[model samples]
Target chain A: MKVGFVTPRYGPEIMGGAESAARMLAEHLQARDGVEVEVFTTCALDHLTWKDELPPGVGELNGVRVRRFPSRAGRSAAFYGLDGRLRLAPREASLQEAERWVQLNGPVVPALVDALTRSDLDVVCFYPYLYYPTVRAIGRVPMPAVLHPAAHDEPALYLPVFGRTFASADALCYHTEAERRLVQQVYPETAATPQLVLGLGVATPPPARRPGGEVLGLGDRPYLVSVGRVDEHKGSVMLARFFAAYKERHPGPLALALVGPVAAEVPAHSDVVVTGVLDEQDKRDVVADALVAVSPSALESFSLVVLEAWTLGVPVMVNGTCGPTREHCEHAGGGLWFTSYEEFEVGLERLLADPGLRRTLGQAGRAYVDRHYRWPVLIDRYLAFLEGVLARGKGRRGSSERADQLARGRRAQALA
Target chain B: MVEERLVAEPEGDHAQELVRRVMAEVHQEAARRRVEGGLQASELAELDELFARHAPVGAKGQRLADVLRHVDARSFVDPVVPVASKKAGGSALKRSIRSATQWYVGFVAHQVSQFAAAVSRALHVVDGELQAIHRELELVAPGPAPVLDLAGTHRVDGWWVAPVLAALDGVPGRVLHGGCGDGWLVEALGQRGCDAYGVDPRVDERTSRVDVRAEDVAEHLRGLAPASLGGVVLSGVLDGMAPAQRHQALEAALAALEEGGLLAIQAATPAAWDRPEAPGEVDLAPGRPLRTVGWEALCRRLEVAAEVREGPAGMDLLVLARARGQGAR
Candidate 1:
């Protein structure tokens, strides 16, 4: 069966959560028997600008066919202002204002949308539920569309636009049960859609015992490491403030290591170390040697880094506010979660003071990753879901015609 | 099964109303089709048998059931029996009188049968209306809790744990099984990799779990800070509490719960509450168990969303959470 993927950004260099998930799913599906996989995405690597980087049109990436479309415009300050207003009061926004919001949200590729709407693929999967390419294209497409919403409890998801988008899809795939519940809470009708909680699969990292502190230029000191973009949204600011307070209160020998893209201001502290983007090997080593890997993001669908930490047999600390992270911790029993400074201090103290506890948690995490998130297991579920879509598609022969009628009606209404 | 909050305005309410309207339209269409199909199989069979007994030549000479299939059962007629003798031995007036009496009896019987058919149709329509009303009421106010007797069996199977854990992800703390009757739920949670403990006003020595303690729920909740506890399960505990006490417990549970922490309330159906003979914990409560409507109203008043699900055995589970922006409505 031929399957296609629609995403905002596509490429090996793109490190965004949805982008990475799309890539892994595509690759895994491509490797399967009797499954033909392809990807349709924008010719841009950066999410902020949506600028044209790769040449537009057809190409190949990692043995899968790729079709890239150039965006008409990049994002701007005007877009942010409009988005902020729209998010605050979406119900009040006029049709014209809603259209403008989508336009300015960038990666506004007419060609990609046209392809998605016109494609005859057996199944087209749209990743995450943000961005113009997904939000706009999903409604217009007449195929058996599957949405992997990667939903979190956030303001943007509650916007009026997503309800229609969710309704238009034939099925939904979720990374976690919490994400599924969030989707159901926002759009109750989506509960009727065929949904499966098939989390994105990650490969087990090769065992490398290289000294992490020496490779990442950090001195031999017990520390808590967070591997992701150092942004306020990812709870970097909160972690920084808490670490500073903890350091001042106890004067401990431990440090806070922030690794990944430096997108936010890092709190100035003598013990805090900011490593901006490490190579794959260095990242593995750092996670393996860290006292405890921390995921502070509250808006995560699934923290891939947490799984990576578990794969490397390391204990983790996650923000309890993030459903997916906390769920992973709860189900795996491989980590602890902290909601406040007090909780954070206690969890940190326990992991730091007791080596046995850390080992037990880390081992449990490794077992969970191996048992549930193996690539083969995920691929099998993916195939079954697609087949189910095909079986359900039999009764949906007139849906395309119905979709066309609805589109025409909407266009006529918009013009008037 | 999950209880989801219906969003306000921006067409959220309109969407639900529209769905209900469409469903009513679909139902009307189905009923219309059924009516157009004439008599159903059972009615047709009865009419065919009636014809077979009366029309001997037609019934015996041909396939009577097959012939009757094309005929409307309601319009089928029984053949008039030849009763009066035509011999001119006695008085001609006597034969005439006998024929008139026979005709009168047949006419009276036909009228009564027709009247019965009309009443049946009217009764069917009334029954349909009653069912529709019941369905609407069920949607607005959750139907009575199922009659589940959890008094004797303290089986703490973690069936409700998945949804509760999903709701409790926002807070970081041990799960508090508020009315930990038999310590089974708390033990199940601990086995499922959660830091959980039970609290109750009374404790049983035969309980298998060791984390439970004898403590009042209100007292335990007062000591916790806002958004401190991850989840609090009120399994049949709220039913026994006074209305004001229950209200206060709800306030504390909401306060102690993080933005998305779970407040799981499981209870028996109204049948248990109404039945004096039924031996159950729900019967011990002074007031009625909370229905879907009251449950939703309470959540709305507290500025939270409650999702409710009813089980087969009259057990209802309510999962509650605080909405975004904290009281945006």
Candidate 2:
């Protein structure tokens, strides 16, 4: 079976979470047996400016065919003012205004949408809901359309047009059950659509070498690591302030490493280390050797770093208000959450003092990953769901199911 | 060494232990800080957190009524919509459309408005009556009865288990054993080819062999699908309960059983409570044992087809009742 992905941008170098996840998924699907993959995206790389960098045409990257189209117009500067004014009364905005909001949130790749609508792929998957290609082509595409909303609780999510975007898709792919519930709560009319909480599968990395803290340029002092883009939007500033206060209260060699690509300036403090944009191996090493891996972002729809930390048998701490991160903690029973400074101090102290608790939490978290998020299990579920989608559009697909009754009978007799 | 071994074992629930302990400490500390006006949360956030748990019962019904009132108030169609528009001649076009459709829309809105108001008023009366009954119960009735550990305090025999197995023989649905500590009876029932499970607050899910849930017996029964169970057995839950709580458990058990289902009950006799040296649980229990005659009277009042049997030594009593309906054999 053949599958296609329609994303705003597609590449290995892009660090935007949603687009990076789409690239990874496309690559993984291309590697599988009997499943071909293609990508239809734009020539833009920089999301802030939306300038055309890559040559616009067909190319092959990692065995998947990619087609790039140039934007008719980069987002005009005038749209920002209109966006700020319309967001205040988003729900009451007129149809023309809402569509304009999506256009301004742009790389208005009209050719990409047009080319995808004419493609012969069995099913098409839209990486994210907020884009020009998706908002225009989702309903018009004749084949079954699967929307990977990657939605967050933000102002754009409430714009009246997104309601139509979510409702028009044949099925939805959510990062977490919490994300599914959040989307359903916003668009109650789409509750009946077929959906799957298919969180991105984490590819098992080879054993990470145990490097000391100096690998991240910090000495061999006990440290905690927080991953992802370090910016105000990602809560890096608050984390730095909280760490500064924690260091002042308990003066010691305990260091806090903010390890990722840095967007905003983190306040320079004695105990904090900001290692911006490490290689993948170094990133894994930093997460692997830490006392705890922390996800402080409150607006995440999916935090793959948490699962990556768990895959290496490390516990995590996250903001309690983030639905997806908190759900990972609750489901695995491997982490703690803190909404205030005092709770953070107390929680860190608890995790630091108890070696056995840390070990058990790490073990439990790895077991959760093994049981659900392993690639084989995820691949099977993904294929089966896609098959079901194809079957829904035409007729039933191939028989890939075991006779469950036979398995049940064997289980009963074995127990007997 | 033993504690270290338990802690180091991956099977041990260290995550649950640590989370419970640290959360308890953090809650206590946060509360103290809030009382001292030192909490860092915004006043609005604190107020929201403060009142999250303070809502009275039946507040949901009252909230529904309030929402209906708002809908009713807004149901009227306004013929005089604002003619302000952004496009050239847009204001004039909107005025013309409003004038053309005003009377038709207003006539339909009048009927919808009256219907919404009627629903709002009817809901208001129901909520008021429910609140009154709740207040009356609070004033007149005794507080909920306390549960005592009869399983640890007293010895029970398998005399009733055989009869229960026979009565529930060929039963069509699953069986539940209330107060099934260690789940010995439920396991035995399952071994006999009976689909059986148990509910006991003390049963550890990791160690128990049977499908025993750590929940209150009555609360578990209330969550079951109506007429889903083939049989239900109560042994120690009725040992020390107020009359109201006892009736509540009985009603829940009967409601969960299908037609022609078995309802087995066993309790210690009042004379059996003479053991003042049983445990502090018995000594401090809020209610005492019920007599066998009282059990018979309860069965009679509920119109249940029941048999009252005295244990061989007069130390225990058993009541076996069948939830019989007109169509049931």
Candidate 3:
């Protein structure tokens, strides 16, 4: 069966969880027996323009066909307020500017439309609902489509319209319960029906000793760790405050490592080491060395960092407010929660003081994650769901007569 | 109080009026469709009998002209009219007028209002068929909660753990299980040397250790001291409450916990409860179905240093610490 995977971002330019998930799914499906997978994504990077030529229309990538359409690179520039040439104005003005720019130079929308019209695929799966162009294009397509809404915030924005549109789709896939609930709340009409529920996969890191090789003050001392984009939403500020409080109570040389892409808006703090944008290897190394992984985000649909921490057999400290993070932590049995600054400080202190508790939570977390969020298990479920959707579609097309006849025969036999 | 009554009555009346108007419109459309189908004299006579049995009764002083006027003005503007026109056009137009006349006579005989009397009669039959279909579908599709309950029981087994050491305001103390559903973790906590007790709402009052009533979570908390209860275990409770009930539970849990008391909150991850239901039955379930809050939002709302932890049993564990100051904001 031919399947088309539509995403706003992909491959070497992979920036977010959804893009990575799409790439992995496409690869796995293509490699599987009796499945032909094709990926259609936007090309936004300039220096890597050669990737655009690698697969012009459709070419093979690890057995799957990949199609790259060059999107307007600076579309996020206005949202980020990076370009000085573009005036910083009202939201409406910025939107107008962004729309004008996309109309003039972007191939994101047209390319999606072209792909939809050109491809003779059985099914199309759209990733991340907020990417307006892809969503709009998917809506226009007459064939059966599946939507994998990767985050809570995106659905919260387009749910009023998307909820109705979703009813027409073959299925809607959600990674986290929080995201699903948000969608259900907005579209109450679709709450009683059972839709697809597929788990998300975490990347497997290479085998390595715990970072600093389990040394005490000499190498690996107890330090609370958090890795993600450094923003207020990520809870970097909260982490900083907690770490400071932790230090005052314990009075150790333990360093709180904050690793990931840094935002200019979220200020850096003393004693909190910010490693901005580490490569994959370095990230793994950091996770291995950290005493405990912390996700302080106040608005995460699902924390990939929590999974990374689990893979490394490290305990996680997660913000309790986010639905997915709490779910992941509790399910894994490998984390602690701190609802307030005082609670965070106390939880951190307990973890720091007790090595046994940290080890226990860490091991439990890894075991929990391996059982549920493992890639192989998740991929199998995803494949089955996709196949089921195709089968359901087949049955929907005038095949009720045979079933009706079978039912009549059963009824007649019962009467006899 | 008088003002409130006066305002509420008018609003209620307006809503009733709207429902009546819509119902009248439906009847008129059905009658027009029937007539358009070119019913013979015998068929018209049968339809008159059908209208007498069906439509909303007692539309006072209704006449054939009034019904015609209502039908011409309102029914023509309806979206269903075009579809009906296409389905049964030429013959239906003639049949519909005849059937409508019969309906008017029936309405006049029944002593209903002229404008809606004919519509009410025709709609009565259509509404019954629609209601029967609705009832049949409901029987086929039993509510999702019972199924969820079964699935939840099987999936949530053997995934319990006693929190290593319960802390209250940076001080260690014995943890008590105030309300442990299923005893999965209560048993685990008992083994771990924490003073854990199983409190089941379902258990016989004589046998149960603690009678944990849904309404008395606060009263239950009154048994513990300000800084004595190290941790409160609320598993699968908050998500199962109405909004007001959830608020009460949270408030009670916060109030009961000591300053800096650890609240080990494990809820069914939103992902587990994320499946979309069919349209129109979203709120039919008694309690909220697990996907109550995002982890971040819950942490933020609870106003504690929060971490989203994964339990060994694949349940989302929120190990929240009580704020040292007052309860959660």
Which number leads on TM-score?
2
What share of the reference contacts survives in each candidate? 0.00, 0.07, 0.00
TM-score of 2: 0.59
The DockQ-derived docking category for candidate 1 is: incorrect
- The residue ranges of model 2 lying beyond 4 angstroms of the native Cα positions read A394-416, B1-21, B34-329
- The Cα error of candidate 2 at residue A113, in Å, is 0.7
Which tens-of-lDDT digit does each residue in A47-115 have in candidate 2?
Answer: 876789999999999999999999987777977998888866676788689898888878898888889
lDDT of 3 by residue, A199-308 (tens): 56776787664453232123545456688877654677656655664566567678777777776343444566776787777678777778788887756656778887
lDDT of each: 0.67, 0.71, 0.52
The TM-scores of all predictions, comma-separated, are 0.57, 0.59, 0.49
Which of the two candidates, 1 or 2, achieves a greater TM-score against the reference? Answer: 2
Q: Which regions of candidate 1 deviate over 4 angstroms? A: A91-95, A394-416, B1-329
lDDT of 1 by residue, B57-105 (tens): 1121233223333233343333244444556654556656656676776
- How many backbone clashes does every candidate have? 6, 0, 77
lDDT of 2 at A241: 74
DockQ of each: 0.01, 0.06, 0.01
Residue B230 of model 2 has an lDDT of 77
Which structure is stronger by DockQ: 2 or 3? 2
A1-416 per-residue lDDT for model 1 (tens digits): 98999998988898889889999999989998898888999889888899999999899999899999999887866989988788666656775776777678777888888988788788889987877887787767767888889777765676666666766677778888668656765564453355567787868797786888877677687777899999877788778777876676679678888999999897699988898899888889888899999997777888899999989889888876677887787667778776445456657776788788688778778877886688988888778767766655622212444334333433443474
